[model samples]
Target chain A: MNEAGTTVIEARNLDLTFQTNDGPIHALKDVNLAINKGDFVSFIGPSGCGKTTFLRCIAALETPTGGALTVNGMTPDEARRSRAYGYVFQAAGLYPWRTIAKNIKLPLEIMGYSSAEQDERVNKVLELVDLAGFGGKFPWQLSGGMQQRASIARALAFDADILLMDEPFGALDEIVRDHLNEQLLALWARTEKTIGFVTHSIPEAVYLSTKIVVMSPRPGRITDVIDSPLPKERPLDIRDTPEFIEVAHRVREGLRAGHGDDV
Target chain B: MKQIIAVLTVIAALVVVWYAACIPMNIKGVLTEQERAGAEVQPPSAKDRRDLSEIGLALNNSFAIPATWEQDRPRLPAPHQVAIELWETTVQKKITSKRSLIYHGWVTLSATMLGFAIGTGLGILLAVGIVHSRVMDLSVMPWAIVSQTIPIIALAPMIIVVLYSVGIQGIIPKAIISAYLSFFPVVVGMVKGLRSPDAMQLDLLRTYNASRSQGFWKLRLPASMPYLFTSLKIGVAASLVGAIVGELPTGAVAGLGARLLAGSYYGQTVQIWSALFAAAILAACLVGLLGLIERAVLKRMGMAQ
Candidate 1:
């Protein structure tokens, strides 16, 4: 759906290994993927699968032991130096001592955004997340879902072209997770920002992603990349639609395939 | 409420018992062997002299009248005596006056604050080193633990002597001792706190192309605030201990420790008690102040109430 010709991130034959007491744990092996500009992609698999490792490799948090990984046509490290993406963790990870507004302002301050620009972006993103008036509230005072929303707002505030989320809604209850999934779909539809989301939930991956990359464990490697057939204009009611079910089924199949199950 | 009431009741009973125990129960202030030999020594007070006339009368009078009510037995120096002493030391005399509790308190306080600052700074640095490097962890962590095992009381005199040899007498030597004792908690707290971020969070930062320093400032340091504050409270208390210990060995002319020594030498029990109370109050105030700062910092970070 991304008409943009630019490939935002490209990983080719990427391999990553961690030296453990037992032996070297191969976290990733010969992984290849490309994310186009404004694309929404999800990496989904069972625990210890290469989904997280792949995500980390793309983020340049972990260096690939072999092969090349690039973001915005540059090395991950180069992209990082250029401040190319915004990241949201599984947990909200908001500083407890900070108000929502201050927490959002932290990256902005570090990245050297002017106060006025920081204020503008903070207000805009807070409004985008439906948390305009709740800026003064601490993360603990808010519900778990709200804290996650605040963190999302913090990522959005920077207005980066890419947003990297690692199971951002994993801790929320099903209802809240459903609500957040819908909100996330809407946000993606509006911003058209490139997203590489990591999740364990098939429904969540199918609901929000344009592309879902399924991975397997024990020397983590990608098994399949399933492109969703559902329409881009997603709504809360879309989850009940036949087309949505078809995509979810496909993601489930991809996950089963990744687990080395015939599907 | 019940706990508070029980504690108060216990304290009241203890006071009553203390008064009873101090009363002349047929024996008076450890009679000398010579006096016990029927030498007929003159009693120090007329009450004692009068009571000696009749054994039953003396015993009855001593038991019947409240020991505090009797002229001889000033039982616990009456609350007013302590109040008068406190007023004269803290209010009547200026804080800087040589005889003032505030003056001695300031000496202890200055050392505590200095030591706390040094300890906290050193602890943070050491924690960072340990967290970042396995070499430092293997090399420094064991020593840090070993350092704590050495009783501060045993080390205080050696610390003073070493500093004196280097021509570094006065506040610096005392402050160093305070810092030595105060840093351990901070190092431990900060190390735990700095590493508190989960794997996913670290990945999130990496995905953003954030460098190590960026990740630290943007993530680790902020995450460590709660831990740092908790350690600071502990560190402040330890710093006070260090400062007091520092005062003990050097024969410092001023400070709560010096006041204690002087009071003990002259048998001014009340002065020693007052000085001990003053030191406790100073430590409490310092810790309370650090707590206030912690609250403010945390609130600013969107963490605390």
Candidate 2:
């Protein structure tokens, strides 16, 4: 993976412990990974496994108490300050008070993008996410799935090379999730941007990722890293193939193994 | 339409009940006076008293009740008396005249408006400061709460007297009192509002590497608006109360409170009732105006329908 191209994100023994009322909560421990340019990486794990936390660290939304994590050879904080990545949270998290167009333009407004540039980028991303005609509407006016798509549009609007998404469609129903998953694949095919995705679904991991990083809870650690053997351009029916099933099974076993440690 | 009908019906019923109540509350006072004005006839027969005016005290306990429906100094002035007084002072009299309710109302309204503006501005500033600084949060919040616990009436005299001694008198002192009453709700509301954005939203701003000032202006401030308006509504009503209370200790000769003092001293219950009603009406108007602004602003913000 390191041989494919220049590394976009590198985490060396990354560690984060949160000081809580109960005591210290070990959110991440010894997370070592390298994400190459234009790679689609999915971090699959159960809740409390630090998958979301790992994604946040890459975006500089959280600080690793120990270890070195860098984005594009810059510290995550520096990269963040330099407008390096666009992040999408678990929920759509659109400002309900703002119209969809304005919501998508929030980063642009903060980053001081010209109004013309903001409008152009907002329109482009809205069309990319298939929410082109709905930018005038507010988030609450849209359905849950549509709002999530709008959130994706918001993340895509800035033209950042890296998209850090934390379970962006986790709350959606299966039907919408499948549709979004396909749209997301098409989006990746078109943009060729490096993506860091967090998910709990095994099939989603196997279907979407060039690399799947499995994580474990309770002092959250990466248990296994599996490089996928699936074709780059995969259709929805590919999930029924033996190759896809085999990769999903491997991810499942990796997750079950992590759970086994708790027992 | 339905809501209007319901409210009007309630008002009408209240006035009816008020008119009915006037009979009992004023009847004893009415009858004793009527008895005093009657011709001396201690052992008079029913026929002797019948010659007196119909429904008079000279009925000699022969009838059910006297029809003394009107009295100049009744315990509870009839609804009509208050209405007539409200009309005579507000509509017929010139607005600038000392005898006019409009003049008194203007004096009080100016104080209320000035105080509300000051209180809201101060509360918002303090709230933002409290949200941004742990020191302000720890030291100022407790005192803000403590300030509210001291009743404004007790504080009013001291505030007025101190301001007077320093050559700041009249409206400013009253406005200060109004400001005191309105401060807490705005502080409480704004703090809640400034902190309303969740962890995820904060993270979104952090990812942008937004400045703290930018975070406050773009996110926290707008987010707190719904809360801000709610507090403003509460603060407006409180400000009016403060303004009226502020007038009491100063022995104001021109505001609604002055009218109340004069009415009470002269035993003009009608005048007092009219002044009280005017104050109530003023408070309602202030609150209603804030409600309209809240709806407009929140709706524009897409926070309300």
Candidate 3:
């Protein structure tokens, strides 16, 4: 296992170009970054900025056309084959056919967990996401926030060391997003998992992430990477603090700088 | 409550139109019969009656109007005439009797059910193959569509004649034709269903390091249930039509198709209409049964929406 502060995911001059009928599309270009163990890293940028694309590259969901990207000291493909991470997409995407408990147990069942062990893990993760008594309910029976929470529980159920979330709360409202952000921080604190989050919100990137990588569109490249100076413990009111605002301002400046020629 | 009223209103309109149509259709026959019984008819001559409008002749001879509904063999049987025949064949006659609609319906239904099972099984297998292999998708899909374009009516007789030459006869030939009509819809529907999972869902399974089979049993199969039931409804109805058509070429004496042929030969329009109604009723029941099963299964799976 990699120690805290050790590099868990490293991307060097990574580039990806999609071949469409029109021509070639540069989805990612010269993207360079390192995500350390137990770090809550947020890739913040607008749509088409390759933040989600970069996260996907680390999860081996998309193959980069050029450069090197490694996860847990091995290639992303090898890490994925070894079941290195759990991914949460923008939608909850829970199978409507399965109840919350069964949905949580899906990856465990796929990974060939023992039946008793699967039950134990499902119960534990359900509680971890504050959905203790709702395991028997179907996904549609729950609200959007609860369904997304159940999705989070599903990702956490297999106990993977890496969690890759691509705008998991993007579909949620502001109040729900804030509550989930706090819960996510608490989850990270307890699990000590390396999380790579992609989002378009500056306050979200500033609040939850220990490291914020600001990115821009048009041939997708990194604009800045800001390491936060705040303590690990955070609350909803922490957004009002000067230090939080300062980091948020820096993220905003980087975003503006990335949009320079276009704006 | 509102729906029942709407349905009843439609039925009433149909019956009224049907009775009015019978007046025009059977007017000449009624007038001829009335003239033979020493009654005066309009135009006074059979040759002159042929040249005038049937509706005009019916209005001029108002005394013969009531007899038009009671014709022994009219061009179009009145609604009540067909209804009485349906009741006699289905309810009045014993189910074991050859004249009973229930007996003929059962024979046709057996073939339809057999063919439906075979078609559904073959369709699902082909769909699975197509979804899994690009070669199967490229080759089999176009052939499946082309098979549907070839009229089953033209194909049914050849199948029956070919099978009759061999020892393979009766239900199997009819069932094969039924299966042929049915399998295409199932293949198209199941293929769509099996591939219903979005890219994100597939990517989620990929992230879990799930194998191809795991992705299928866990996601694809369950996702396909709704589509499967929908296709089954269509397939079952098609199967009934195929079975009825299959009975036509062989001059089979035991099914609804035989009943239709016999009725037509004797100019028994009432019998033909009754048999048509029976076949339609059978098809409706099969589709309704499938719908009930769909609701139950989807409700159990919590996929009703």
Candidate 4:
């Protein structure tokens, strides 16, 4: 589980309630989690489970209304300002006006990286996403899967120590999603960066993570945290293993328990 | 090619309709002149020859219809007369001649171009303000609405008189009026464009910890291009209208509005129609230029098809 290092992200009794026009909607409540360095943790829950909200908190894109949340031993906002992590949103979110290379260069430009450095970083990240020769194409000119990879390249360009991915492969079909998952696992293995991935897919969660966090909605709270015993070097056939099946069954049970709590 | 053919067909139809309509409108002048000519022809009972039946007959009888088409001071001039007048003033006369439409058209074009620049600058500034600050959005938008509601015709003379009183004359007041007309569309379009980025795009910039100015430069401004050019086209046309209206009250000696006034005073229907056509042509060219610019810029940015 990569427990040899200090914690990268720590949450304690975190609460977030959005005051919408209808009323106060509880998004997260009494959530406690600790993610150590170089660990791949997946947050798996159904819709409205605040799994996305929790990822947003880590990126400081959303503020927690109560309790404490920390990234890299500092406030999430500070960590964000210091460029601690790269975030991949659900949609590619590439600026339509920019080519793939330029889109990846956005963060570098924002950070005032030199033109040469920006170019170097963009090339390296494009290679990382396996989109090496497609840098000159516009986002719309590329296939949807290619566009998503370009967005991942954009996030990875600045060489941050952590990557916060919000269901990046959720929109893809099974085949492309499987391909991306394998590539992501390979990328993670090479980088050894802390990753907090949010997803709704049980198989995806089981396949990708060293640790899995199952969350419940209607006042989102952590229902269970499973430390998978599956080997780190998992192939596509790992899902057939009895141990993998057992963990997947436990995750399915945790999800059912979450639905039962609300109904 | 199809578009050009379609446009030409529409224009040909319009000319045919115009020529037919002129026979009815100018029939009275022709009938009276025919009576003066002492031709022993029985005049159809056409409410003194300016009625529908007489016009229909005139359309059929080529011999009699020529007189109506050639009336000295007809209610409606024939399409050919207007065309002839336009050719003579624009092509036959020297450019600097008092009789030349070119001189007047140049004046109006100058004012339109000047006003468009001012309005574009003011619009972009106001749009930036509105997008960045809530107070500006609330305050400026209502005032912009009020400004438009106050009729340009009512506002033009007041602007002229005030500018004259302040020792400002000629093109500045006209440009100001044009600027006023053009500014609103720019403001509205630019605001929409600047805010065009979706929630996810904005959140992405925030994740990068980009400042507001960075957000504006990197995302908002570039996104607003298509909208800006569209508004600019509308604004430029409105500016031309403003410049012409500004010429109206002063009874200016130069400009297309002056030509319209002069033609009206002397019962020169053909001249007025010609001047109106010239103005319309000028407007088309301006908008066409904007379209060309839009294509080049959007294509460069990879935003064009």
Candidate 5:
């Protein structure tokens, strides 16, 4: 650790279980991870691999059945209460009735930001997302990619220091996903904010993240933690480089090993 | 242009058919039979008598082209006849004249509005309660559905009688009946609307740590607008039915239902028809007005235009 307080997210031996009609279902087991401040970390795993569950726990949406998880050095619940992070769901989740501007202002309004400041922030984020002229439009009128961009702008509007994104670009086509991944990288660089992204795509995880946390299913646990070799200045061409492919191959090997498949 | 021309052609064909049907091909006047019995009868002009009888029948039937086409058809009074009667009763003699439809219409409108407000309020409250509690969902929803199954016509008189015994009359009784009929749609619509938010959106709000009231105000209520407005349209129409049904009992002197009753008693078919038409028009207008408000509110919220 660089400093005692430098870690933005730290979870130690986290475990989660659910009660079912048949019996207890172990969802997560003995997962440990630490994310540094301003780091872009992506968690990649198969279905039921607890990637989303872990993200939820960090966001305080789910309680870990065992172990301790802290965000910004505070308990998940406290951090949630303090609004320490902005969460972006897999779906856009834009309120259909609210305009683009209003949707972006939702968190700001809830946090009681002054109208002028809210408008200022909203405008800035809208411009940042390249949706400045579409402020008056509703979410339903926008294309899927545009809606996702709006959702990102919404998260950015609150100016939160940490972002917990659960497959934010999972629903987009490959082209849109690639485009969004680059834009997200650019956004992360500009904001210098810590981000925890959950995705299943190996290449996507390898391309965007400074650190990759590969997880395994069946009592989900971290299988590998791969520090990316690529530089901070990532461009679209970086995806085609030998270094990017090597990281992606490592991630694939890690996933196969976790699944007990020959690699 | 094609549609308008087709409609005009159909209307003109109907008029010709009506004129042909009413030409009095078989003249059977009472005077004609008497003249045929050859007892040195001083005969009136047969053609003149037939013409006079046809004119009388045309006047009675209000010169409606459709009416003259079918002998056994229910009397389809022409638009002019109904209009003439409506003008004489409503405008010539004002509402106090006891024959005025305006007075009856006001009475019915009052009852309908009162009932509509009460029903809508009750529906919203029940919907909120149902949304908040599982017990209310299990208990109140089934009974609300059952309440609608009880015919309004059957319930109206009993409601009137019950209210009368409890020292309630006039608007209250009528309003209660209207509310009873109108509330179910609002409840159903509102419940569906309130629960409309998707899992992802709800999770987003939960992640934000928004309170229950904040979530409801920010998400649920706004999400339910389209459903609520659609239900209000149905509720308003139902309330109008309730008001009319309420008037059927107690023989109220100043309501459209009472006008219908009086028209039936005096065999003034045109009066009853006009009153019925007016009630329909009022209900349509009320629904239209609510639709207008729905559009305005939704537009302001940046929903669909």
Candidate 6:
């Protein structure tokens, strides 16, 4: 792993304006932030707050209209071409025609990995996501939570150093979401990869992140970026602790403050 | 079981309606035959019979009911006449014999299958090109739509003539016509299907920096399967029609179309009806085969739901 303090993603006055028939809408505006190596960073905000857009930009799925955004000191597009990160969308988005293992092998196939190595990596990631035995099943055969886990495994199979997720658990029930959240934290701990997560949940944001960036809509921009002082090794019960509650409160304040500007 | 029973009920209703309609149509011929046989008949002269309604004649001559259904050169063959002809031509006659419906059916089917294969192959290739290239989509799609607007019946004769002039004879010309009729549905369906993957699915591949070919092979092609099968069912039926139509203008000596034409020339209504039934049955079999293949494939792909 790179040095702990080494910046993996840096956005400097990032601006994205989308021109539509109605008018120009700012998706991200004057956004400035830094995500260090191995940091679990969560971007929390309301709908249209550009939280998802920001993560998409990091993955190079969307291009910023103006300003500089870099991943691992390279342009997002360049970083993407280098396969520096894996992305999980809100939906699992598994191809129905393929088994979970085959879906996980998709990127490896595109990148021209050997057949044997592809299987090995697939098995490893399936195990990582607690879907080891379920690899033979198709996406439709699995429950939504299990399907989402398989998708996460697919993203991890390629072992990119950075993971970008856009509300990956947004569709799940609360119980399943909580369970996946704990599993995700465990996975992140084992992998030690930098993560950029976009979500609307406060406790989830507080529970999972080493740092939280709260954002709002209407010329979407960040209101505050808080570095958590909580210990890295956190359990599910950590949410009950005063420190976790304090950070959660700060995140809520930042979200409100961002929303306050629009109203 | 309920669905099968429902289908059988519908078929039974149609047969009853068909048998009822046969009475009025064949009554005149039945009357003529009976008059020739010197039987006592209302409106004794043929001219008088022409002025009288066939239904009225049938009501007056209730004795002629069985005769109406058994005429050798009847204007409309009864359901039993067509069925007997179908059964005899398909089963009693040797398959290799000229009189055999199976032989004619095979001739038409071979052309349909060949044409379907060519059309589906071309259609999928064109669809892939259209999905990937804006220029192809603009240029090729309009022509495909325009091609289908010209009725196959109107075009079949010209195609036969042109192909005959080129020394291309027999099944190839018919297959070409079949391909022409079938290709459009495939192009339309496949274009929609190949474009079926949503924005998020495409974006996932983009995040992986997957090449265009990768996107196509892994995403677009497999996604198009359900659409492909639907269009194939339609295409295969269209192909049969094309093959049958192609046979009509060419004065072909064999196949179901030839049998229909020959039967018409001789006023052999039974033969024509049998040939028509054979064609219908053949189309059903082709479509049913496609449905089976589609079900198995989609089930294996885990998309059966």
Candidate 2 local lDDT, A1-263, one digit each (tens):
32457799999999999999999999999999999998999999989999999998888878899999989999998999888898888899999799999999898899899999999998899999998899899889999999999988888888588999999989999999999999999999998889999999988888899999999998899999999999899999999999999889999889999888575
Which of candidates 2 and 3 is the stronger one according to lDDT? 3
Which is the leading candidate under DockQ? 3
Candidate 1 displacement at residue B247 in angstroms? 3.3
Give the clashing residue pairs of candidate 5, or none.
Answer: none
Model 5, residue A131: displacement in angstroms? 3.2
Candidate 5 A-chain TM-score: 0.96
**Candidate 2 — which pairs collide?**
none
DockQ of model 1 vs. true complex:
0.48
TM-score of 6: 0.98
Candidate 1, chain A: TM-score? 0.95
lDDT for each residue of candidate 5 in B104-173, tens digit (9 for 90 to 100): 7888999999999999999999999999899999999999999989888888889889888999887999
Where model 5 places Cα greater than 4 Å from the true spot, the runs are: A1-5, A21-24, A261-263, B1-96
* Model 1 regions lying over 4 Å from their true place: A1-6, A257-263, B1-7, B13-100, B121-138, B161-172, B194-202, B210-218
Q: Please report, as a residue range, the 10-residue window in candidate 4 chain B with the lowest summed lDDT.
A: B40-49
Cα lDDT tens digits for candidate 2, B9-119: 999999988877766666555555555678333334444544455334324433323344478898888888899999999999999899999999999999999999999
CA lDDT, every model vs. true structure:
0.81, 0.89, 0.93, 0.91, 0.84, 0.92
User: After TM-score superposition, what is the CA distance of residue B166 in candidate 5 from its true location, in Å?
Assistant: 3.9
Expressed as tens digits, the lDDT of each residue in B1-305 for candidate 6 is: 99999999999999888888888999988888889999998878899889888889999999998887888988888899999999999999999999999999999999999999999999989998999999999999999989988988899999988988999999999999999989988999999999999999999899889999999999999999999999999999999999999889888999999999999999999999999999999999999999999999999988887
- Best candidate per lDDT, number? 3
Clashes of each: 12, 0, 0, 0, 0, 0
The C-alpha stretches of model 6 lying farther than 4 A from their native spots are A261-263
Give DockQ: model 5: 0.68
Candidate 4 chain A TM is 0.97
Global lDDT of model 5: 0.84
DockQ list for all candidates: 0.48, 0.83, 0.91, 0.83, 0.68, 0.83
